[model samples]
Target: MTDESLVRACQTGDREAFSALYDRYIKKIYTYVYYKTHHKETAEDLTAKTFIKALEHIDSCDPDQRFGAWLYRIARNTVIDHYRTARPALEIDDAWDIPDTSDIARDADARQRLAAVRAEVQALPSVQRDILMLRLWEGLSYQEIAQIVQKSEGHCKVIFSRAIRQLRAANALAAFLIILYATHSI
Candidate 1:
């Protein structure tokens, strides 16, 4: 069923329709929340809360808006509220934080790279990172992202373009450091 139909059913208190909606969005919502918060447990909690809040207020949502964007907006707000309450600082861990060097080295390496990228992303002002994440990760169109972020679609495209440039620069620096390390090792 289309999201509109599912939402319409949900608005009338159809439990199965709500479950279907949750099934469709849980992973995307979780991923969006997890990357923003950088905490697994908190992300899980907020993912649940986002859906519950949606269920509670689904009637208030405009039917014309894409349900995915609406759910994402809720997830974003939930994460913001979490940050407001926790006010935790972001910390970068050393490369050796993963203890199992043999079995998990590949996974660890990927996670380390992702962590580095996430750190670079975190350094960006929230608006830019939010736009990048919505566009790149969530596969949201500029128009949809603009709706969620309350910006013009043209402005959203500009923000995403700048964010991509910033990410490219950070990646280039990382690549340069890797080359330096390899040369030093030799």
Candidate 2:
């Protein structure tokens, strides 16, 4: 069923519909939360909380809005609230327990680069990061992101543009550091 159909069913008190919604979004929501908190336990907890909060307030959700965007907005707000209350340290953990050391080593550099980018993105102001994640990571359309972030579409577009520029700048800085390290090594 389409998200909209599931939402309508949920509105009419279909428990199965809500479960379907949860199943559809839990991983993405967890990923979004994990990126922000950089801790497995907290991300897992917050992901559950996000769904709970969404269920509690499902009636308030607009039927016209895409349910995925709505769920993501809930997840984003839950993570922000968690950060406010917990003030958890954000550090990327590089340990992935894949059995093959060779495979792990092969991807280690790429994983480290992604972690650095994630850290840089997380360091952005919440508004910018939220919009960027919703647009780029979640693959929401401008209008959908605007709806989720409670901004005008034009404003969202501007914010997304600036956020990308900031990410590019951060990447350039990382490149410069790598070059400096290479020169020092030789």
Candidate 3:
């Protein structure tokens, strides 16, 4: 069933619908949280909290609206709340695990480049950085990002482009690394 249909069923008190929604979004939400927290445990905790909040407030969801965006907005807010309560050090884990057959030299190079890009991305304004992460890391479209960020689609696109240009200007290597990282070809 479509998300809208599932949401409508959830509103009518169908637990299965909510389960389905959770199943569909769990990995994506976890990844989003993981990227922000950069710690497996915190990401898992925040992701659970996000889902709990979503379930508690499911009645607020409009079936006509995109459920994915609504879920993401919840996750974004949850992360904001977490930061407000506790400013913990971020652990920058390797973005991807290397396969056994991968070259050790290439893997080392990729990790160094990814570290540089991560630093550059963190320096961007929150909105722009979020736009970049949502667009690239999550592979979300501008429309979805706009809804999650409560901005216009065009504005999100412009912000993403500007952020990319800024990154390119600051460190050309960082910009290239981000693209490769996004495509998982690093």
Candidate 4:
């Protein structure tokens, strides 16, 4: 069923509809939270909290609105609240789980490059970083990102472009790594 129909059913007290919506968005919400938190447990907790908040406020949801964007907005807010309440303890190991490769030297080199790129990306302002991740990693459109970030689509594009430019100006290699990673060629 369409999200609108599912939301309508959920508003009418259809538990199954809510379940369906949960199933549809669970992975996406979890991934988005995980990207922000970097800790599996924290991501899981925050993702659950986001869903809970959505469920509680589902009645207030406009069926005519885009559900995915609304869900992302809740997730973004939940992460913001998490940060506001406490600084998250991030472990390097938790941030990435690269598989073992046959060429140890090549693997080490790639990991080092990836680390540089990650650091550069992390240096970006939260808004720009979030916009970049949503645009590249999540493959979300500028329109969807604008709704989630509560900014104009043109503003999001400018932010994303400026983020890339900053990365390139910081390190050409880092920019290349970002491109490789975004295209899943890394």
Output the better candidate (2/4) by lDDT.
4
lDDT of each: 0.74, 0.73, 0.79, 0.79
Model 2's lDDT to the true fold?
A: 0.73
Arrange candidates, best TM-score first: 3, 4, 1, 2
Per TM-score, the best of the predicted structures is 3
Error of 1 at 69 (Å): 1.0
Per-residue lDDT of model 4, residues 1-186, tens digit only = 999999999999999999999999999999888777665677888899999999999999998988888998899888777765553453122233222332212233435555646667666777888898889999999999998888999999999999988877888776566777896763
Cα lDDT of model 3 by residue, 1-186, tens digit: 999999999999999999999999999999887766655676788899999999999999999999999998888788777765543453222222222243422234434556746666766777887788889888888888999999999999899999988887889776576877986863
lDDT of 2 by residue, 107-160 (tens): 334355555465566556678877876677778789888877888999999998
Error of 2 at 109 (Å): 10
Alpha-carbon deviation at 67 in model 4, angstroms:
1.1
Root-mean-square deviation of every model: 7.4, 8.4, 7.9, 7.5
TM-score of 3: 0.79
Ten contiguous residues with the weakest lDDT in model 1? 91-100
The parts of candidate 1 lying over 4 Å away from their true place are: 88-111, 168-186
Could you estimate the TM-score for every candidate? 0.74, 0.70, 0.79, 0.78
> What C-alpha lDDT does candidate 4 achieve relative to the native structure?
0.79
**Candidate 3 Cα deviation (angstroms), residue 7:** 0.6
Off by over 4 Å in 2: 87-115, 118-123, 170-186
Q: Which 10-residue span in candidate 3 carries the lowest summed lDDT? A: 91-100
Off by over 4 Å in 4: 87-114, 172-186
